[model samples]
Target: MRTVLDFTPLYRSSVGFDRMLDLLDNASRVASVDNWPPYDIAKIGDADYRITMAVAGFAQDELTVTQEGNNLLVGGAKTGDDSGEYLHRGIAGRTFQRRFELADHVKVVDANLTNGLLTIDLKREIPEEMKPRQIEIGQASSPAQVSQIDQGQKAA
Candidate 1:
């Protein structure tokens, strides 16, 4: 089921929230029926994530995993020997390429292929400057101290 959501009302009221609204508007336009080389995305830890792809009938050399900036690309190209005849041919042998958009500071830590599955591990490493930390509140200067400082400045 799909319904149109008009962001006109939000645009009229909200400020500095256009990016979030754009994301919501763009999300609905993405195709929901793209299920080639099925994959699963899971959050394994607070800042860790896992993307496991069911890549049966594909070899390690045939698959290529690349990370460029905020984008992750996973591609598989079946190499050599498709000449053999088959009756049923149930197993899929089509080449596939999937792209994943990663958040800021999210990096691909490791990737492994085992038992017909490809698993990619991602960890979000927030920079020290970006991570939330408590700011030490300092005591405000008293009126007496301010007046003394002003007097000292005048004397100088």
Candidate 2:
């Protein structure tokens, strides 16, 4: 299936959308969709995020979280029970997959499963060069250094 993305017209007016176009191109190449175990992604802090998935029948031991380059891969498989009888099995009980793309320097801090909620925490580490710095101002020693006095002298 081909998606008609007429970004050329949009790209002309939106200079900020250049990166978005690259992301959309990457998304077009991903030809798989495995929407097992509905999940949610939330921004917890300025540079932190969390991904929560509703894995009701899955235990912590059954799930796995892995990081491959710039993407986070989450998957799980339930061990079959030989003794348990399934008279009416409606829920899905197979391996599930979920992928999330991370920005540069973003990493998974930890993953925890609590009360059927699997939460994956991610934090983006800002580079020391990228952090904001305070620039100190010096007191003017000469009257000419003051911009108001300079303008007054020019008027005179």
Q: What is the C-alpha RMSD of each candidate to the true structure, in Å?
A: 3.5, 7.5
Clashing pairs in 1: none
Point out the worst 10-residue segment of candidate 2 by lDDT: 139-148
So what's the TM-score on candidate 2? 0.69
**Which sections of candidate 2 miss by over 4 Å?**
6-20, 29-32, 132-156
lDDT of 1 at 21: 86
| Residue 3 accuracy (lDDT) in model 1 | 80
Each model's lDDT = 0.93, 0.86
**Predicted candidate 2 versus true structure: per-residue lDDT over 1-156, tens digit per residue:** 678566678777887678778888778877777677889999999989999999988878899999998889999898867487889987777788788888878999999999989999999998999889998999757765687778888999
Per-model TM-score, in order, reads 0.80, 0.69
lDDT of 2 at 33: 70
After superposition, candidate 1 runs with Cα above 4 Å error? 8-17, 144-156
lDDT by residue for model 1 (102-144), tens: 8879999999999999999999999999879999999999999
Q: Which has the greatest lDDT? A: 1
